[model samples]
Target: MTEHRHTNSSTGGTSPQLSQHKHEPSHRYSTGKECNASGSVTTPPRPSGIHQILCIPTGKIYIGSAVDLRARWGTHRWSLRRGTHHNFHLQHAWDKHGETNFEFSVLELVGTSDLLRTEQAWIDRTGCAARESGFNISNVAGSPGGIHAQEWKGFINPGGNEATIINLQKFCREHGLDFPSMHRLAMGKSKLKSYKGWTHRNSVRQREYIKTYDGFITPGGRPAGSITNLAAFCREHELDKTHMVAVAHGRICSHRGWTYATGKRKLAPRTYTGFINPGGQRMLITNLQAFCREHGLDIVHIHEIKSGQRKSHKGWTWREG
Candidate 1:
């Protein structure tokens, strides 16, 4: 996989072996297809440029542009035979289809500088990168997206009744989320409901009782027992989860028997600019979303006023702290 942008090596067994003679440059030897007058196979300089390996039976294809097509093919075959191909999709297909079912052929010949661009054009024209359509492991032309690289699928934050939909990778980096774990969760590969009280925006597995939720409580609202997952607790007690969150958030005074005993992050305080209310009242607001909800204000208008894009929103005006 050359997704990181490097010359691609071949997968054929006829890889270039170290030259036995000191004067001759390293030459790639085919499997003895050509022979000297002695009637033996011959070695040939590797061909270069855009080439493709096709699974004849399945019609799957992998495209690349590189020098030393033979050497690149050798590397491909070496990795595939060892079950270590960086492009897992191609490897998987190869495992299912017999090795003899594949063939390598050259496409358009291009200079080294144009290899990536030309290859990308071919990939786009062929639609080889479409999922399940071809063997390509990356949409990027020269990028094979080695096994370690992951495709990002955005996620949602489904806390309370509100939800936040955003790029999962960027969100994880900004919010200090565990990328691997959250990735699994977002991809629907993990059974975990929530991580540290944060929820996926559109996870089908999301439930009223979450793993990161605070725990069970006694009906008296006094000290209660704790649990690792609310779902597990609900299952064990045959309890309804509909009102559990309400009780947890104090929206409902109490539910069957549960209270929120949750851990909280201690963070440095934020200095919010004091804004002059239309009624001539100065209010120090920290959470804009919450304030807008409380006063039935449009957040966008408030942002415009604060940024000086507009003079004011309705009656709200921006003022410095």
Candidate 2:
């Protein structure tokens, strides 16, 4: 077997360093190995098989199968520790019990070609999919998992009601809309467009938290006019809604001789740390005002990211200092 180890210094000595092992080549199978959190070696059988993560206190097991059991276990541990695992139930249990209370084990070694079939048989025999039993979400082994895939569409629209259904391809074809774009929106992978009422039967309208703006004011603090919706105001004035909101919140004091007045008080500004590329130069600014003054960067764009309206500002990233 050939072995390779990876040391992660950023973990502060808490996380276990990972070691990967590859077995000598076999005509019918291959094996991978790793070390678990307990500093114990994991059994990686030739090719595929059933695996389990057992919670000692609860006696709850998460049954799974993988082509490479050791690699899968490592992936699970990494995701669970990072709080980004897809299985919320397993993640919750991990959080409650910590690594010490959990055990990773291989149940049976199966041929690579029989992986899915054997896995399905094991799942059926164990009743892993039953609620209050195991952590397996679906009884069907080797099925495509996650919320964004087409397999989940049936789960999302279980009723299959034709009345409420919106055929994405047909609708997009008729309307001359981009099929891929509309498909993504229908699949809940992208934001819904306001221009069309195009929505799938399972589509859930996201509740938007709209902020009320009173009106725009002049430089002398005189009332310009009342505008209820920021988007409407932007359209009427040909101003960017993002920029206007930044101005309204006092991120930028004024835009084009117009000041904003809001009935709701703005949030307290936060300090941010900025880093420049190429040389990794760092700067600390107390607020958007200080950042604008120091860097002479676009005030509106900086405000967008600082206020969480935009993710990135001119290819630069900022975090709370």
lDDT on C-alpha atoms for all candidate structures = 0.59, 0.56
lDDT of candidate 1 at residue 218, scale 0 to 100: 67
Q: List the residue pairs that clash in candidate 2.
A: none
Clashes of each: 21, 0
Task: Please tell me which predicted candidate would have the highest lDDT against the true structure.
Answer: 1
TM-score of 2: 0.43
TM-score of each: 0.38, 0.43
Candidate 2 lDDT for residue 277: 27
Please identify model 1 stretches exceeding 4 Å from their true place.
Answer: 1-47, 146-186, 190-321
Write candidate 1's Cα lDDT for 1-321 as tens digits. Answer: 211112225433122222122222122223225333455555323655676666667667787667776578677878788776656677777788857666555555556666677677777777778766677867787653533244444443433334443444445556655555675666666677665444554455765653555354566756555455554455556666667766665566556555555522225555457567889777788878778888899988888888889787768887876
Model 1 accuracy (lDDT, Cα): 0.59
TM-score of 1: 0.38
